[model samples]
Target chain A: MTERVRVKTMMPPGHVRTPAYLRGKVGVIERELGGFSNPEQLAYGLPAEERPLYRVRFTMEEVWGAAAETPTDTVDAEIFGHWLERL
Target chain B: MPHDHPSHSHEGMSPSGHPYRADNDTALTYWQRMEIAVRELLVEKGAVTPEEVARQIDTMDARSPANGAAVVARAWVDPDFKARLLQDASAASREMGFDIGPLRLIAVENTESVHNLIVCTLCSCYPRNLLGLPPDWYKTRAYRSRAVIEPRAVLREFGVELPDHVQVRVHDSTADMRYVVLPARPAGTEGLDEAELAALVTRDSMIGTGLPRTP
Candidate 1:
């Protein structure tokens, strides 16, 4: 079972699927969306390493901080497992 | 402004006694030309069949937001179907005869407390199998960045106003998976039948960029 986690604030230099604004953000695992070939490696035509993908749910507050118009709102993103760290 | 002339033809003689030519109406963009060239080359090289390419194009052309509207309308009336749809979108779409291709499709429901919004931050990844092509704005960099940054404000710009207590959930499709929002049925739509309800569902509503028109 995948667990809720926070995205690591790492700025790796390459083709990445995770958005910049979502780094270091806390979100709960809505569901595991199965594994797929890592897109980062695929972009470079390298051997693709399969990685688990999850639909992560974040409170609007977690992403936008004070700028969030609706503090109670939530957002979900499909992210690979490697970007997430256990909260 | 008056282009309704009875004798509007380009086959006229110019002052220099030369035939006047009309502008090229069927102009292809650089990218479009490149795409056609690549597709044709692939077919010629036996990498892909021309018929297969034509079928794929036809399938894409056959799809529209109306397919999504029909699904949402069915879900509003049938509880069992709604549960199945929320559980497995691709299968549910297929049940209603929608060809979802090979991509994984997920349907997020909007309830009394939670409202669902769909966006593709990386690219314009969407359930095109049902909702047809992504709109021009959906592919904009501003939308991609702002939708995730300030979803509520963005929703407001689209004229979707949720109550303070309602929690808006924005789904950012980033991978092979595609998402479609199953928008909440408007309150006054209780007396409407399935077809009428479907008519009420707009393309923007399915994208969570707008609400169903109030009856």
Candidate 2:
């Protein structure tokens, strides 16, 4: 394939766990940071290691713009175990 | 922990001779306990090495306003692209490398010709794949509460002054999906290319606060 395509995900409104803080903001897929089986089902009383998933790197500025002023500046955020599409 | 040996439980008295009370959930900070517990537990369990975590954080140094810049640039250069964005934002965004992720996105166009405002009443639902994250104000209770009741006032805070009847349609984004407002292309930018136009469309403009920059 594309040498292991980089994947990432964001949740829908009501059920999404990722805060709206990161929703709809633009960022690049920094890299594949391994993967999680599914932490949600575990968190919400589901069996552990049951949530299927993907995750990757996204910078804070990519999501917040310049207004997110800070010395550290970049926020290397991790998305989740699922919800991704080709870039 | 103390074990009680009384035949019947005592009421309004301390279990250990020291008053026992509980904190209210509403009075508590949202997810504060969970955040601390998770972070501490992760460090304790050694699931993610501390040094690695620091290294991961170090990578955030590369972030930039390029996405906003790109959006503004695209709006400047192409009329057809802008029209498509106004018509169907998700599809148009894909053309610009923004894959709209798990939640679908609907972009409402606001213009000199027509104005539109967006809000999510049921919490701060949003399209994540296109824009990186929602601003702090977008998630504030003040915004969620007022956008529906007094959109004009909220917009005014962002320096957007609207006419008496610009047909403001306030949409409520649910927890299921989200929205983004595509403010109208400004004047004096009639002949620019797609890249030029995108530069004009700032994050504020997309949220219906500020208008796109002209010239």
Candidates in order have lDDT scores of 0.86, 0.56
Q: Worst lDDT window (10 residues) for model 2 chain A?
A: A68-77
Cα deviation of A25 in candidate 1 (Å)? 1.7
Query: Where in model 2 is the C-alpha error above 4 Å?
Result: A1-87, B1-30, B39-69, B72-76, B79-88
Interface RMSD of 2: 13.2
Candidate 1 - chain A - TM: 0.93
Shift of residue B195 alpha carbon in model 1, Å:
1.8
- Lowest summed-lDDT stretch of 10 residues in model 2 chain B? B57-66
Tens-digit lDDT track for model 1 on B112-211?
8887788998888888888888899999999988887777788889988888777778889977688888888999888999999999999988888888
Error of 2 at A68 (Å): 35
DockQ of each: 0.71, 0.03
Give the per-residue lDDT digits (tens) of candidate 2, residues A18-54: 4455455444453343445454454466665633333
For candidate 2, the per-residue lDDT at B30 reads 60
Error of 2 at B184 (Å): 1.2
Residue by residue across A1-87, what tens digits does model 1's lDDT show? 646699989999999999888899998999988889999999999999999999898887888789876777778888899999986
